[model samples]
Target: MTRSVALLAVLAVALLTALSSIFIVDERQKALVLQFGRVVDVKEDPGLAFKLPLIQEVVYYDDRILSRDLDPIEVTPLDDRRLVVDAFARYRIADVNQFRQATGAAGDQSIAVAGRRLDSILRSQTREILGSVSSNDILSSDRAALMLRIRNGAIRDAEALGLEVIDVRLKRTDLPRENLDATFARMRAEREREATDERARGQEAAQRIRAQADRTVVELTSDARRDAEIIRGEADANRNAIFAEAYGADAEFFQFYRSLAAYRASLLEGNSTMVISPDSEFFNYLKSDLGTQ
Candidate 1:
């Protein structure tokens, strides 16, 4: 019975040993086998992997793309205007061996270490590239091109840390809180100044148009008066000519007509008295048979 118990204990120890020596590498992970705290073998392929029990251990690193959010950074543009920028980056560990060596951290802590190191690299590049351009370029659709430049600048530095920088993006760019009021005030003042200039131009045009209209009215009035005076003088001259022609054509008839017109003038609605010599020529027309036709 004691022999059977001893054999059972021996089987349990072997089973535990076998379980400890074998490890599974997931599809999403790459494992590094270390003996006595030194890297000995790498197990990148998924499936079962083996290492000496109680002598070697395995450390796994993610074999997939990762992301990190960088802290907000301030940059002064070419115009000396400062802007606050929020950004993030996407990266992948291309060389686990180099990554482990560069980070000098074991287990999951190395991932954190990589992220912190990448932050510094990206921040420096972001400041350098963004500062070289104007604020308008950073705020406009050209921002995409600026982000590409920043990513390119960081790529070289990231490679030294065994990281491949896939892309970097500027999430938000804004004026500093203190500058907002000043910017808005300046914009408002500019709009008002433009409005004033436009109104002045409109007024000047209106005045010019009014002056032209006034001049037209004065010219037209003077021209009409001169034409009326000419017409009146011509009518008077034509009537005088007709009278002179009639006098020349018949002296006796014209004299008789003139006497009759004077008679009509002397006689009025009331009784009229007129003393004249009987031999006077005024009586000639009355004396005759009512005057010639």
Candidate 2:
């Protein structure tokens, strides 16, 4: 009975020792082998790993790429204008050994170190890039180019820290609320002033065109009146000249005929006042007629 109990106790201890020696490393995990408080090996492959019971320890680390969304950071442009810039980045561990050397996996020291490095790199890069450009450029199509520069800069600076920057992108860019309102108001006023100036120019041009048209009308009207007056004067002169020519050709007959017309017109009047001799040339036709009657 004593031998059986000792055998059972030995088996239990062996089982516990075997359990302690066996450690599991999943495909998503990278583990470091620590022996006597010092890391002896790094295991990135997925499988079962062996460690001495109560002598070696294993530390697990995440090997996947991580995303960091930086909050909106305020920066001043070259023109001394303030802007809020929101950015994000994707990074992964390139050198697990160096990562572990710099920051242990316990207590999130690795992530904290990465976060600080990323923040410092991002802040310095963003300030440098934004300070060299105008606010309009930062907000406009140049943002693509600026993002490329930022990513390149991060990749260059963060590689020594066992970090590979996959991409850096700007999510949002904005001005302060007060500045936005002031800028919009100024732009509105400038556009309205330009419109007013254009309208004034258009009106002035229209007035000039109208004035020129009125002058042309006045000139045409005056020319027509002058031409009509000249034509009328010519017609009157022609009529007088024709009559004079006919009268000059037969002066004695014209005079005798005119005197006979005058006697007929004067003798038929309602008021009779004859103060002429009977032998006068005015009564020649009247007297002959009277004799014949």
* Over 4 Å off, model 1: 143-145, 219-293
Best candidate (score: TM-score):
1
Could you tell me how far off, in angstroms, the CA of residue 52 lies in candidate 2 after the best superposition? 3.0
Task: Write out the backbone clash pairs for model 2.
Answer: none
Q: Which 10 consecutive residues of model 2 have the lowest summed lDDT? A: 284-293
Off by over 4 Å in 2: 1-20, 35-37, 100-113, 133-149, 152-161, 227-293
Candidate 2: tens digits of C-alpha lDDT, residues 1-293? 99999999999999999999989988877888889768888888899988888989988877778898887898899888999899999988777777776665553677887778788898889888888889988989657889888889888888777788898999999988888899899999999999999999999999999999999999999999999999999999998797688679986566666776787787785887888776766655456654222
lDDT (Cα, tens digit) per residue for candidate 1, span 157-206: 99888889999999999998888788999999999999999999999999
Report, for every candidate in turn, its global Cα lDDT versus the true structure: 0.91, 0.84
Reference-based TM-score of each model = 0.69, 0.66
The clash number for model 2 is: 0
Which residue pairs does candidate 1 place in steric collision?
none
